[model samples]
Target: MRTYLAARAACIVFLFSGSAAAAVSEEEFAQLRAEMLRLAERVGVLEEENRELRQVAEATVSEVQLARTEAQEAGRTVEEWAPGTTFSGDFRYRYEEIDVESRDIRSRHRLRARFGAVARLSNDVEIGLRLAAGSESPVSGNTTLGSGGTSKDLYLDQAYAKWRPFNGAYVTAGKMKNNFYRPGGAGLAWDSDYTPEGLAFGWSGEQLFINAAAIGLESDSRRDNHTFYYGLQGGARLPVGDTVSITAGAAYFDVPVQGESSFFGDADDFFGNSFNCTDADNCAYLLDYEELELFAELTYSGFAMPLNFYADYIRNLDADTYDTGWLAGARLGKASAAGSWQVGYQYEDVEADSVLALLRDSNVGGGGSDIQGHKLFGSYAVARDWTVGFTVFVDNDAGENRTGSGTDYDRVVFDTIFKY
Candidate 1:
């Protein structure tokens, strides 16, 4: 019995000690689990921070690349905006000698000088201006003016603004040469010797082109009281092929005459009688006049010798008359060729009762007998920007009129031009 009791006691003690050790071990395991959970949370936070930093770095890199691309594109655009800006000018000096067979005596030598400037103001605009100084010698006569005078009267050969607002439309204003007839010598026929201040508007599209304007006129001895001269013109250019073009145009002018009397020897005389009538009864005897001009031209640039043909008709509304003229010409020169030449023949027919009759009857030897004229011109490129040229002009009446005698006139001109 004693042995059994001792063994039982020892077993009880062992059970208690084992229970205490299990409790302590459980506590240590709980602490270790807590530490492991904290470590995991810290590692998760670090991972999140790394992901955010990577996103930020990627965003910054993308922004920098975009900026670089935009800068390069802007640089390319600037280069294309203004392809070229060029400066160019020209100088022309002409010496003329004249002999009038009808006047019996010859005139002195005349000198002329002209300067011009052409500039590219912008991608769509161009500007030009010119200054000329010379004696006013008639193409056929021995009269010269403004020879020894001051050069203060510098004419504005071209002071205008041009804009290409659309793909095929252009507008210009401020004292430009009028576009009346086709772009040829005939087109320049009515341009004022002195530049006139005016406004011109033009429109051009794929199939059509039209230009119109109104201008101011300077009063002269003939029409001393004239306030303004207005004109309207329209033109159309049609392309027949890659190198040929046909153009047609019409022009009208309205002029008011005041101050001075008698139509003879007056510039306004071509329109109608210049008699000032204070009473309606006297005004009934005067004829009101308006002038109309119609013109057409054909240009061919495909051949070895480019050819141009022009025809024009003028009608006096009140005088009930008409005049017709035509010109056929060719330019046989190349910009890179050694020699260049231009030859033309012009025929101007004026009836006995036409407006040109007054100029004919003034003994200016230009009227009344069906005037025919011929022109021969040639030019040689002595240097890159220097050229020398000569021209001869002759006019003769074919002797078809029985009431008036025929007249004949001849003229020769030489020119030298240098440009840069």
Candidate 2:
């Protein structure tokens, strides 16, 4: 019985040992599978992180390029806004030592200084101002309001507002110099010394051009008075070819002169005598007068030598009879090959009548008012911005009454100008 019991115990021990070994193998296999799954999950997380980083890098690069492009566009905008802003001006000083061989005045020395400024306000607008210092006013005779001494005056040489509302039309308003006379090489009138407050309109296209203006005339003394005069002017320029052009224009003015009044104390003896009149001795009185002027100009600039000729007829519209006066003038000028030197000749003639007679006799009158004149002028460029000029002017009295005391007068002038 003891031997059978020992054998059974040994069999149970063997069975239990085998079962424990099997359990141990299963646990090891399960641990290995779990570790492999954990490694795969980690690899997937790393790959996703890499993809996100790449997207962020690409987005950052795109933003940087956009910023660079915007900076370039802003710089271009600024460059266009201030294109070609420039400054320019000129200074002219002239000395005229006059030795009048006539009996009116023996000798005189005159000095003139001029300064001007031109500014480009925008692509289509510009402003300018000119100041002058001299012994005489810009009036033809160089007359002064007060004493004959050096004086400084500010002239609105070009104080006008200009605008190009359309591609081919421009309008301007303010005090503007008159365009009645062409730009001549000589003569004070050609200098645009007289500027009237007015409005001007101009239009130009490929083959057509027109300019019209209406001006207000004011007295030299009472500038602010509401009393005023009006003038109408218009012109057209036609091109015949690449080198030839023709222009024509007309102007009309209505001037009103103020009347004078006086008070006569009461009671002269009754005129038992009455005034009588007959057709042969008829006399009439009027309180007002009007002046009218007509003008034309022809220019040939395409010729081997350029030339300009102009004429005008003036009449007293309110006079008792039909009396008319006229003016005729011509100019010739040439430029050197290098455009450094310019020479010119000018001739002007004036005819006399009743109105001209009164004007010539006025205190502010220069002999040229009713006289013929000729001018010879030359200018040389000393530097890019400097020029020296000389002019000789001669006048002859060709009036009905020999109104200018002398038959001839002459003057010579020298000038230098610098530009900035």
Candidate 3:
């Protein structure tokens, strides 16, 4: 439009002027029109480029938004479980050999499997359940290979509720795992499989720890026949320096029972054909022993591997006969981290009626109180949360005066375990 207006003005000036000095030549008008055409063409090209750029920017934003949505959907798929609810368990395969003195030594293959889940409501309260592969036995969770059983059997190993009402304090009840402290990794006083049915509590400070519990061992149909077990333990952990620490504790257990219907029954079969009680039905009574135990452990980390030296002593406070037992051991390393290894050896001398037979180490001398043994064990963590382990027991039945078995009874166990 500007070009047309300028041309009209130029024609008017040429038509009305008497002098031709200001008149525009035809050639000049033609040049001006060509220049205007070139300018308009450039503007049109710039406008088209701007439009294409806007479309590209919109498409890039849409693609980015789509990617973000897909990422959020994938995250939701993995966030299915509620917070504080976790699942974990382990499975073990074992081959065991039981060597007896002056008798036929037997060997067997066994297996153990466990699955557990825990749900936490808050920092103070949680509930857990566990399913284990075994019949209800205090000491043994092993399933014998080729038992000809039609179906696999599983038992509730642990069903418990735990609460921490305050700092450094806890309460647990139901058929829960043993809450008592084990001095040297659990073989001395209680079997690994022995989950106690009771209510237990613990309170701790910076260095001092206290524990107490009351457990129902056997419940009779008749009211008075009910049996109970009670325990109280206290301890302290003291660090000497950067490399040395000591842990010591004293514990007392009161078991009040005497009858054919003993604590959990002799199905544990700790006693052979000759049991202390003269009952006809497979020695059904459990020998009542009130135990008082003191234990101390010393750990030194100034070596290639951490070293722990431990000693545990127990006396049956109520026994009129044999009344004392002790165990000493040392272990190198914990064998917990991947590719780490551990080895340990323990010597145990337990007198008859010195400790409760129903709950002690089942693999050593058949879980009897009248036994002495040397236990050697080694373990290696092969992969993450997996381990291969071996244990050996060279024990003898030592009744009062060591007259029960002059011969040796040995046992060996090899196992591989995987945990998650």
Candidate 4:
């Protein structure tokens, strides 16, 4: 446009200056007009190029804005779906052998895998879900190896929500982790893998802790009564010396089972609890369980490796006889680092009707009551998050009713475990 205006101004000046126009020849005038035409053509071309450049710049800006908007939307969607989520998993492989008094020694290979996710919904609330390799057994999670290479089952191991209303106080509901204390991991009353379905409450102070739970035992709409288990425990830790500490606690459990009814749809599931069977489907518990437990642990950290001595005792107040169970053990060191190792030895005597047979340690005394045994276990961490362990159980029947009565029972387990 500037060149076009300049060309027009030159023509106007030539036309107004009559002397200058007359002095120029016709040929010169024609050449001047041709030059002016060329300048006009150049201006038109330049304007077209500028128009294309403007359009290209606008399109590039539009694409950048669109990409920015899409990226922000994606971030918001991710936040809604995955707020503070974390994943955890562990796997264990085992070789086990069980020998009874007169029966053939049984050997098997087993594997257990567990995967879980926990998400934080808020500062005060969180939820967890876990899947495990196992059947519907409440006390065991091992999947036996082999059956024509059949696919294994995956059970819902945990589905729970936890809410912490304040510091050191929390509530949990659903199929949740056990909140009750087990001194030195003793399985006299509860198994490690037994996740209960119900509600649990806990409070912890600097030197004291308390736990309570209301668990659902059996629920049947057709029956008039449903069974439930309630538990409460409180404990305190006291320092006796410079490197010595003692922890002591007491617990109470009430289990009221309806008579003349089968639990878990199988009378054989009693696992040595005193019961009378009327038929294959109808059985009655001999006694209701009102249990009182006293537990204590003493730890001395004066040595290079800490020494822990613990004892657990439970008595069923409702039963007349065979209603007591006890365990005493000592552990040295801890298998927490790559080069660390630990060894433990415990002696257990569990009589029939002492505790619920179905909930006690499954591997000890081959799964439940009427058993007295010694358990020795050791573990070594070869690397971080990886460990190998061995456990041996030497047990015998305390009563004549269980299989292979008055005979020796032994079980050996070798395990390799990995965690992430």
Candidate 5:
């Protein structure tokens, strides 16, 4: 543009100089100069508009690239999903103390960690798996806090599939988490750590629930006998008023055996140095049982905090003797969220055959049946997904008068737990 302007100036100078001999008109020179200025201004405006168009084009290209990259990332995520899935679990550090009637005293520190995941095959079907830091301890999933040089044991705690073919119905199979609700979250009927392997069906509605399961408890190859556990439970939940609600359930469980039912909570042969039934070492036993358990819970929300009162009763119709168990408690607060505090107290009288000795709450007289105790517990959520809790059990054998009855005991547990 500058060179063109300079050439134009030179031409005007030459024209004027030449025109001097012809005595040229001044108006023609002025008109030519004005036309040059207008042309330069138009070119400048066009150049600026062209630059803006280039910038707009570049921006559009950038947006296209970003969209392509996001699409690729979304494809990768879907390809990795087996349908779709979520993962969750918790960990806890526990300190325990057990003193038996001024005689036997024991203390231990333990760690319990478990992780699980669920993958949806569709809205109607899903698979779940839980892995834990312990062996096959059916009633306690804790690993002792020591033995550093030794390899830790990790077990498949649960591997199951749940299917919902219709509204308010679920069918589950394999070793699965308990589907029954215990009044006041009591551990009397089913231990906290017990996961039964079997087939189960459950249904829930606005005010009613039903659950049933058939569990394979044990197998005997020599005698070709099997122990099967069957259970059915139905319950109703009702609101009494604007500030109160009540829930109740009736349950029946039958654990029948061909002969001696020995597999309830007996230590595994590998750990307890006892021969399994399959072993040739002459190990055989039996337990025959059927239980009718009733449970109830009442909540009053009108208090400063919610107050929950709960009770459970169970009787073994097939036990030879001492076959009754019941518990009652009241809890204040849910203790589920951060900054929440909760306290609860319960008293239980459990006979030897009332509930399966091996599957009852381990904290009650060291997880054995034929025990009576007051369990007091409290918890505080110190942070999100973390809590500190303590539980005290003042327990004694219900059948202490009988020969070979277990001794009396008091147990305390302090734990710091984490969940995510």
Candidate 6:
């Protein structure tokens, strides 16, 4: 544009200086100069408008790119939501044999399968559900194989919701997992598969922990018919040194026995607890359970294999006799990964009324109280998520008083388990 303006100015100057000036008037030259100035101003306005349009186009392109990026990010957020929901399960097959003195030996092939799902609804809330292949037994999930290949049944094992109101504290409701910690993972006070229905509270810190629960044993609209179990436990972990630590805790549990028959057992059943016979066919519990428990565990990892020693003691304050029970055990190594193995031994003496009969270890003493036993167990991880194990229980009925009333009981179990 500058070059065009300069050429126009030169042409006009040449025209005026040559013979054309003789015929042209001064008025014509003045009009021509004014027209050239207006034309230059118009060109400058057009250039400014063009620059503004170019900037607008660049900004529109940038906005479109940003919108596209945001859409992709929204798609990824939707994909990430599914990961917050997870599924897990395990399967176990076992061959079990039990022998009782003066009785025929019993053998069975049993299998247990459990599938569970957990959904993290938010940062502070979660929901869980599980299904198990077995009968509606709180202490066991196993189904014996028999009945000419009849199809097994599935039962609702767990349905619960958990909420974390703050750091290191949580509340659980519904038919939830047992919230109390079993020292040494022992089933002296509570069974491994027991899912109690009610509300539970728990809190844990670096070295201290507490658990409490209100378990619903039975619900009846009739007065004094409802039964509930209440439990509270507090513990602390203390470090002896860098390679050794000790954990100790105490717990109290109250189980109400209001009627002759409860949800767990029939009127004729005592399960080694003291009972009074109302008639030839009816019996009632003698006392309510007020159990106090003490537990301790010591772990040492200074050697090639870790060693763990644990003890559990319980006393029913409501009973005068057969009220004390205790167990001591030691375990060497851990079978957590492939090619690893573990071996453990434990001895336990549980007199009548020491703990609740239906809630204690079902695998010992024919699933009742008044038992003294030695348990030897070992496990080997054959592959990832797969393990083989065995347990042998040499137990006797402590309630038997006659000379060898022939109540010696022995049980052996071999299991193959797979987890996913």
Candidates in order have lDDT scores of 0.52, 0.50, 0.79, 0.86, 0.79, 0.85
Candidates' RMSD to native: 17.3, 17.6, 9.7, 5.2, 8.5, 10.2
lDDT of 1 by residue, 82-183 (tens): 444334455555555443446553433434445655466777786656655542311211123444764433444567777777776666766555544444
Worst 10 residues of 5 by lDDT: 267-276
lDDT of 5: 0.79
Q: Point out the higher-scoring one by lDDT: 4 or 6.
A: 4
lDDT of 2: 0.50
Model 3 residue-pair collision total = 0
Q: Which residue pairs in candidate 2 collide?
A: none
**Can you list the residue pairs that collide in candidate 6?**
none
- Rank the candidate models, highest TM-score first: 4, 6, 3, 5, 1, 2
lDDT of 4 by residue, 1-420 (tens): 677668676875674476766978878776776786676677779889988999999999999999998898777744466768888899999999999888999999999999999999898899999999986889898999999999999999999999999999999999988888888988989999999999999999889999999998775556644777899999999999799999999999999863735455476467778887777766788788899999999999999989999999999999888889999999999998898999999998888888888788887778778888899999999998999999999764545544455557899999999999
lDDT of 6 by residue, 293-365 (tens): 9999999999888899999999999988778889999999988789998999999888888888778888876
> Clashing residue pairs in candidate 5, if any?
260-285, 260-286, 261-286, 261-287
Question: Worst ten-residue run, lDDT, model 3?
Answer: 266-275
Q: Who wins the TM-score comparison? A: 4
Q: With candidate 6 superimposed using the best TM-score fit, by how many Å does residue 182's alpha carbon deviate from the native?
A: 0.6
Task: Flag the better candidate by lDDT, 1 or 5.
Answer: 5
Count of clashing pairs, candidate 1:
0
* Model 5, span 1-420: residue lDDT tens: 557656766765665575652564688767765676677677678768878999999999999999998898777753375448888899999998888765767898888899999998898999999999975778779988777657778999999999998999999998999888889878888888989888999999999999999888764456443667899999999999899999998999987652543554343322111123655543443345688999999999997779999999998887666778899999998667779889999998887667666677777766656677788999999887899999998854544523455567788899999998
TM-score, per-candidate, Cα-based: 0.57, 0.55, 0.77, 0.81, 0.75, 0.78
Which scores higher on TM-score, 1 or 3? Answer: 3
